[model samples]
Target: MAITDAGVMYGLLAVGAGLATGLAGIGAGVGEQGIGAAVVGVVAEEPGFLGKGLFLMLLPETLIIFGLAVSLILMFAWTPFAAFMQ
Candidate 1:
């Protein structure tokens, strides 16, 4: 059997995964930050509206949580290429 250098292939895949996670996190952070700032402004104007503002600000955070879950899943799951290389 010939020894194939699978390191490059796995490295590319890992890089892709890192990029996906980074982009996802950046997007989520921006979204959550905007919402949080808006909520703070709204609450400052009308303290009674704090509850609604808080809920809205928190909603965008779910995307980040989902992205994290996806990252975890990818880390644990077996890739076909990894198996082939083995």
Candidate 2:
């Protein structure tokens, strides 16, 4: 079928949402990798520091959560604006 304006807009929005989620996930993964390495090193030096190391490593995970929220908003909360645009 031929693509209409509204269809194109919807596709663009979907792509944008996907990008946001994907990028955030990538960033979180990269960040966690570094932090995880550091945490391991720190823990290796002092076993009692495990809890603090774990906390620091987990902090990067918020990027994924924020990305999920943005994706959800784009998928559902933005529907009204999409309809209005069309």
Q: Pick by TM-score: which candidate is best?
A: 2
lDDT of 2 by residue, 1-86 (tens): 65567767677778988988999999999999999999899999999999999999999999898998898788768965457455
- Listed in order, each prediction's TM-score against the native is 0.68, 0.80
Number of clashes in model 2? 0
In candidate 1, the residue pairs with backbone N, CA or C atoms under 3 Å apart (3 or more residues apart, or in different chains) clash, namely none
Tell me the tens digit of each residue's lDDT in model 1 across 1-86: 54366776576656766776777788878888988988899889899989998888778677777666666555556475548456
Query: Which candidate number would show the highest lDDT if scored against the true structure?
Result: 2
Error of 1 at 67 (Å): 2.8
Query: What is the clash count for each candidate, in the order shown?
Result: 0, 0
The CA lDDT at 44 in model 1 is 92
lDDT scores of the candidates, listed in order: 0.73, 0.86
